[model samples]
Target: MLPSAIVSMTEFPLNSNGKIDRKALPAPEFTMERCDKVAYVAPQSPAHITTCEILASLLGVDKVGLDDNFFVLGGHSILAMKAIMAIKQAIGIDINIVNLFEAQSVRELCVLVDAELLRKQLEETEEFEEEGVF
Candidate 1:
């Protein structure tokens, strides 16, 4: 498993007995360092914006950008399930957890969601044609 945070120090804090002081260690700072790899891209479409909001809420972050990585944002398997469920509830489209693992970005997920929406629309249109509703 990847470490949640890493701290670099010149020397370890020691107790009177010369043992390392665990409590004296500084708290690990959690930063969005992973996001530095990619330029921050704002969400342009409604679907993208909504997806970012859901992820940000789930991850307890203030904001989520289109290119933000889910795992880097502290999402795990359990959280992945929650995210998929949340998306289904919010957008009315089911997303496979496997796709989340493969994509892991709001922009990529919106692409999948858009494709599923189009597919559902096509299915409804076909059913209407069959029933001569059009």
Candidate 2:
């Protein structure tokens, strides 16, 4: 796991017994900051837009771009699971958690979801043909 922020201090606060005071350290602030490493790219497709919305809502951000990294947007494992569930509920498709970690972007995730949807459609078509329904 990566730290959200780093705190700089001149000296450590100590207790009466000479032990470092844990409570004296300032709490790390976890805020949503736009990723600077990559330029902002707006979502272009419906699937990309929906995936962006799910990630943005979960991370408490205003907008998510196509190339935004989920972890860099303050998303962790728990939020990743919620994202998976939200995508399944909203898109009617199941995605593995590992895929989210591997993809880490709205564009990548939408591609995975789209592939899964197409695979399901193909399976249904094959089943229908086998059953002589069409």
In terms of lDDT, the best-performing candidate is 2
Tens-place lDDT digits, model 2, residues 45-132: 7777888999999989888888888998889999999999999998888999999999867778888988988988999999999999
Q: Number of backbone collisions per candidate, in order?
A: 0, 0
- CA-lDDT, candidates in order: 0.85, 0.86
**Residue-wise lDDT of candidate 1 within 18-103, one digit each (tens)?**
99999999999767676577777888877778888888899998888888888887888888899999988988888889999888
lDDT of 1: 0.85
Q: Could you tell me every candidate's TM-score relative to the true structure? A: 0.79, 0.88
The residue-level lDDT of candidate 1 at 96 comes to 88
Instruction: Indicate the residue-level lDDT of 131 in model 1.
Output: 100
Q: In model 2, where do residues sit more than 4 Å from their true spots?
A: 29-37
RMSD of each: 3.0, 1.9
Cα deviation of 13 in candidate 2 (Å)? 1.2
